[model samples]
Target: MSTSPTDSVLEGVLADLAAEGDLLETLVADLPEAGWRTPTPAAGWDVATQIAHLAWTDEAAVAAATDKTTWDALVTELIGTGEQGVDLAALAGGAVAPVDLLSRWRTARTDLAAALRAHPPGAKLSWFGPPMSATSMATARFMETWAHGLDVHAALGVEPEPTDRIRHVAHLGVRTRDFAFAVHGLDRPTEEFRVSLTAPSGDLWAWGPEDAAQTVTGAAYDFCLLVTQRIHRLDTSLVATGRDATTWLGIAQCFAGPPGEGRERR
Candidate 1:
């Protein structure tokens, strides 16, 4: 049997997820007991909290993919507790021991990958924002893993090797341009803006009209970092031309939420 286009996309996303998960695991595997409690770049979150949050989210993703009832209940509980913001989830996970939390994260991530693969490619899964296809959900999981991994790595004072996997995140950032604007009570850009990025392997990846009046041009890794709010826009090499592109860069966010208070410039 030939692989369908959707199958191919899902496979690619799964591969990316595996790579991201491995990176995260390898980065924090050797942390000392003190290191687990060390503060990360995300305010009020420690290394243990970061991994716990990932574990929690992976379990949630599995529920979203495989069991709507459970997923809906989880969402209701989260909302009912008034637990808003990403940090709350991380904080909630802080009680687990480091070893137990790491093990749980590994299992949850594996289960999430399996669950996502089993989901129908075209079916929409519920999320914090609009429903997402399995591919988009997988990609979102990859992005979250990468972003949180960055925080973990930062807390440890280490840098992760950039990979082409960030292309998925960069694409999500571009696609969410209009959504970001809308979430902030601003109108979407009337005209499309060109987005050109140089991938980690020196290959150019792009989106939108090549001749569009507005343009965002930069390294793919930097672009991903910007959209994930892992770095301040001013700290990146990204250059945005035209008013719309510039504005979008300032407010760009890939995750669903109210507008984030992005990182301040170093």
Candidate 2:
């Protein structure tokens, strides 16, 4: 059944969440005990710790859905921590340990998705700060699932083929172009930019104006990896077609927050 973009976005995220969870399960099924302790691509965090953090995030998602006060407080705490001249990188990059965090994360994610699916479309939820519709909340969850899956992909050395659904997520990156510009204190270009992605199903997912002067071209999977900060900008064949396009090429971000350091060509 066809659904509105808002509904579709959440639906897609839920689907992807389920799929990624299955993949993670398979990836860790036969691993050695010490493999869980091995460091992941995320600086300083090992596989076990990453799983634990993912679980914590799932719990946070549930809290946001049911506890507005706690949700608001958590977001405030995060932003305050960021603004207090705290070195986020340093804080995030310390203490890589393996723990039994994955199971909880997996379970929470399942429960959260189920609860969200049952909520009314107009349901109000507290996120980072403002009250967001249930739809926006779903999109946020999708963005995190895709972004974190990147970490798992890196750890497993396996490249997940891009599904047409990725375009659903990638579109978030494209539409958020203005926000990305604002993140760097730059004015958002008044002009539109085009994006084309080749999906795994042998179908094409296209967005923006065909005649847009600025364009991003590449396989859809690569584009997803780039925007999600999974693969390095240089590692992907995705290219920008206009003057400032390249500058914005690798900097696309759909997830929330005060912008992050864009991926660099290492």
Candidate 3:
């Protein structure tokens, strides 16, 4: 059968997810025992906790995609619990051994990718923010894995090689501009802002209206780092040319939840 538009979108997302997953797995594959205990950029979270959090979120994603009852139960439990935030949930993984954490993360991530692929193309899965199609959900998973992977690599004092996969992250960042504003209790920008980035392959990746007065131009990797809250806006090479764009760069966040404490410029 010929591929549908939704299938094509999901296929691309799944490929990105695989690339991101492999990058993280390779980075942590040979980590020393002490390295697992090393504190990452995320306050109080060690490398082990980072991987465990990925595993936990991956498992949650699978449930959200495949089983509404299970996903709803999880949502209810999280809501009922007074301390159901990202940091708190991630830190809970500190109790797991490093070996077990890695194993669990590997299994859950693999399962998550499979579950996403199996989900109907047009069906929406409930998420922390809003319902999303399988393609968008996979993209979110890739973004999270990449962001956490950066934290792990940073703690180990290693820089991950840049890849075109970051295009997915950059796209998500631009798409979430409104959601970021809403999360911060601010009004969304009335006008569209152009976002243009130079990808690792030296191709131009862009979004929003081409002739929009507001624009953000920069390296794709830096843009991804900015949106993921891995680096502060002032620290990157990104140039925001309008008030809205500038303000967006200051508080851009790809993940769901309250604003995060971004990294300080070195």
Candidate 4:
């Protein structure tokens, strides 16, 4: 049987998600034990804490798909709504040894992939924000993994090798434009803004009307880094044409929660 378009999209994002996770693992897997304690860009979160958070979130995604009771309890406890920050300390999973933590993350990510695959077709999974379909959930997971992985990379003094997989992150950055505005108590642009990102493979990935007055254009990798708050907007080559679009470049965020102060200007 031929793969349906929907099936292909799901498979594509899930595969990209797995690859992103593997990349992070490859960077950190053989690190010295003391390296796990290295501080990252995120305040108060060490390298181990960053990985632990990713693993905890993967497990949470699995619970959201497979166990309503656990999911609800987790959302109420660890997943905060706007105004409050996530209690990362609560989701630490108590893995003290570096090996134990790495093993936990591996198991959690594997379980998350299985849970997403088994999710009912055409059904939505409840999240901190609006409900998400299986594909959307996978994309969000990939977005988070890449964002957090940057933190680990920075702590380890390694430059990330950008890939086409970040198209997922760039897509998420575009899709969440409205949410980015909403979270910041600003009005969302009434008309869709044209977004043209140059992908790593030299292909232009774009959205919205081609001739839209308000537009954002930049390297897909830089845009992803901006939206994830990994890089300060001032440091990017991104160009914005209109008022709303210009404001977005300053505040864009693909992940959940209120807007962060963002990285220091460079």
Model 4 ranges off by over 4 Å: 79-85
TM-score of predicted model 2?
Answer: 0.81
Q: Note the clash tally of each candidate.
A: 0, 1, 0, 0
Give the better candidate number (2 or 3) by lDDT: 3
lDDT of each: 0.89, 0.68, 0.87, 0.88
Among the numbered candidates, top lDDT falls to 1
User: TM per model?
Assistant: 0.96, 0.81, 0.95, 0.95
Error of 4 at 195 (Å): 0.7
Off by over 4 Å in 1: 82-86
In candidate 4, residue 190 scores what lDDT? Answer: 95
TM-score of 3: 0.95
lDDT of 2 at 94: 24
Distance from true position, residue 127, model 2, in Å?
2.1
* Candidate 2 regions with alpha-carbon error over 4 angstroms: 1-9, 83-99, 129-131, 159-161, 262-266
Deviation (Å) of 182 in candidate 2: 0.8
Worst 10 residues of 3 by lDDT: 81-90
Ranking by TM-score: 1, 3, 4, 2
Alpha-carbon shift of residue 59 in model 4 (angstroms): 0.6
Model 3 misplacement above 4 A:
82-85
Superior by TM-score: candidate 3 or candidate 4: 3
